[model samples]
Target: MTTDHLLYLCFWCFRSIFSVITFSFTSSVFAQQFDQQYLIWKQQQNAHDLRLESTLTHQSAEAVISKKLEPKQALATTGLSTASERVNINQANVQQLQKLKGVGEKKALAIIEYRQQYGSFKHIEQLKQVKGIGESIFLKNQTQLAL
Candidate 1:
């Protein structure tokens, strides 16, 4: 090769090698910084999570205490009737059926229509056979249901 070409080639090789070494050094420094920052973030996250758990536990305990203090009032507000006041699904009207948990107007009407079409319900469990009434609805209203 010509002298000028040889000089240019050597300069390019030196610049490339210098760039690689600089990049590697910077990468290691950046990786260390990133790892340290990540550890600090994890520690802060753990502390915040602990604080949230404490707050949630305190709130739940207060809720349980309040419910225990006024169980009958809570039951009345939740539309759960006592055993003596249980709704007879075979005889209850749409409004009476609606008083059961998870039973809206549609569900109540569905129950009445089912009862009329099938005659009196032989057992409380038969309520699950109606359309829109599944296991969850039947279980929720089981205590309030009768023949």
Candidate 2:
């Protein structure tokens, strides 16, 4: 072949090889970028899942603590008495004294009013000042009642 033709062939082959190398390098770089992005996304998702799990655990712990606290609060408020136990007219408030078997709202209010005017009861007999309570009711509840 002519020298000019041979030179032209060599030039074309060199151009093709350069183009292939450039394309391979570009493809490798793009693939590496995609892999890095995928890894970052996976890490973010894992972190989000961990946060959600921790929040749920905290909520459950709060619920359990609330459940445990409720009975203690009830015991404190009710003075360790069951519903059947007679309430102390002297020490009890209007709301607490009203929970007694025979006591109603009016009686409860009357007891508070009498206590406020006359001060603390010295004996169970002082409860007779309340409207509904008489000798018989006081006698009946005397064993269960307190000062």
Candidate 3:
């Protein structure tokens, strides 16, 4: 072939290779930019979800705390003896009797059952008849007891 024709063919081949390399490089750069944008969006979504979850958890905790602090209205509305008064042997429940000093759940239930089967205690001395009570316990709580 002629020298001029050979040079022309070489120039066309070089131009075609350069064009392919440039196109590939540009596409890769665009793909990388798109991946970075997608990552940023996903991070923002995760942060938003975490914030919503935290708010819900705080609200539930506040609801539980408020319920615990609320007073029991049944005892208040009955217009019976106040909470500070000595527990009535005739009418006191196990829960109420358990508030006394040194009284546990079993002792409180025993006191209630004794009152139910027999009758109201006429005096503090009668409390000794219960299984758990003795002279020392009666003496210690005598001032706090009533008919």
Candidate 1, residue 139: Cα displacement in angstroms equals 0.9
Superposed Cα deviation of residue 35, candidate 1 (Å): 28
Best TM-score among the predictions, by candidate number: 1
What lDDT tens digits, residue by residue, belong to model 3 across residues 1-147? 999999999999999999999999999999999999999999999999999877765655555565553233322332223445576656778776765666788989889888888888887788999999878877766666777
lDDT (10s digit) by residue, model 1, range 1-147? 999999999999999999999999999999999999999999999999999877765655565577774554444454445655688899998878888888899999999999889899998988999999999988877777878
- lDDT of candidate 1? 0.83
lDDT of each: 0.83, 0.76, 0.74
In model 2, state the lDDT of residue 129. Answer: 74
Q: After superposition, how far is residue 62 of candidate 1 from its true place, in Å?
A: 30
Off by over 4 Å in 2: 68-147
Rate residue 28 of model 1 by lDDT: 96
Candidate 3, clashing residue pairs?
none
Query: Relative to the unseen true structure, what is the C-alpha lDDT of residue 102 in candidate 1, on a scale of 0 to 100?
Result: 88
Error of 3 at 83 (Å): 42
Rank the models by TM-score, top first: 1, 2, 3
What clash count goes with each model? Answer: 0, 0, 0
| Candidate 1 Cα misplacement greater than 4 A, ranges | 1-80
Judging by TM-score, tell me the better candidate of 1 and 3.
1
> What stretches of model 3 exceed 4 Å from their correct place?
68-147
